[model samples]
Target: MPDLPDISNIPYLPSPARDMNWRDLNRFKSSDRGSDFYKTCLDYSQVLWRQRLPARAILCLDRAWGADLTGDEPILESWPLPYQALVYILQNAPTGVFLGNPRIHFQHYADRLGEPRLEQRKWRSWACWALSCKARPDFQSDPDHDVEEPSLEKIAQKLDQYGHIEETKLWKSILQAID
Candidate 1:
């Protein structure tokens, strides 16, 4: 492919989705390209979010989450950057930015999370593990997966309980909730 377009002036770009060639983004997929691809997508997503184009930002984030060389296990258990970005977006973006119910949105992504592993197990392990806490009683259930936990609601509640907390502290609380 041609050299990556100068993304420095993302604000001035017209037709960002096309300018970024989001549809063909997966063409860059390769084992060696995973981290860089994810980081680039994350950076663009953040820029789009700050540009008041949250819907587009979400598309970028979703693509980042689907980076071809990255496995869901690494995304769930090892990748801190994606987790941090996801937490930040979930905390800051308005629910209206999501096309449907936010829970359903998460659940949808969670459902699609590890197709390779999906057929091996009757129940989803990683994403469902992350989401099946009591706080989200609405999620799909797994008999072996129920854990008393801090759900996304718990994270949001903590954020609300302590108004204007430091960014690091906020990230800590969110991680704690998900962990």
Candidate 2:
């Protein structure tokens, strides 16, 4: 695992209300308060990504997405920023930097998370195609999948619908990278 990115420049922490050391973070990992644990990890992951430490960010995302041992309780369903960030990394990051197949990791988490709504499904397929630079598999195909030109406009519109102004700003920043 990589070192935690420097987030001192960031103005705010997301949840749990206090600074937590590794020990404190670990304590909640196994606790029944899974939502708290998940949010902390997800918030930290966003910080890491904003700091341009994607490798470390991925670790935090892994923890956040897997925080709940029992799959029945879905904590992140309402939070789409993390999923968008994951797709950004998947499409942009080099595969060699990570030990195992990043796509497999993504697929596993996506399966666990289950199929998203139509808008998210389009982004997922588009991201997958962007990563491979090849035709998407039939199973992942979408009517909006324009092979010659993939636009983030639709995804941005979807984010707008969610009404998370901060996340919308973050999504715009992420789009800047691709543009």
lDDT for each residue of candidate 1 in 110-138, tens digit (9 for 90 to 100): 44555432321112222223433323344
Model 1 stretches astray by more than 4 angstroms: 1-27, 30-33, 68-79, 94-100, 113-173, 177-179
- Candidate 1, lDDT over the whole model: 0.44
What clash pairs does model 2 have?
A: none
lDDT of each: 0.44, 0.47
Candidate 2 lDDT over residue span 38-142, tens digit each: 677766765654555666766676665445423334554445435455555545544345423444444443334432243443444333333322211212433
lDDT at residue 170 of model 2 (Cα atoms):
60
What are the TM-scores, per candidate, against the unseen true structure? Answer: 0.44, 0.39
Error of 2 at 160 (Å): 27
Residue 37 lDDT, candidate 1, scale 0-100: 71
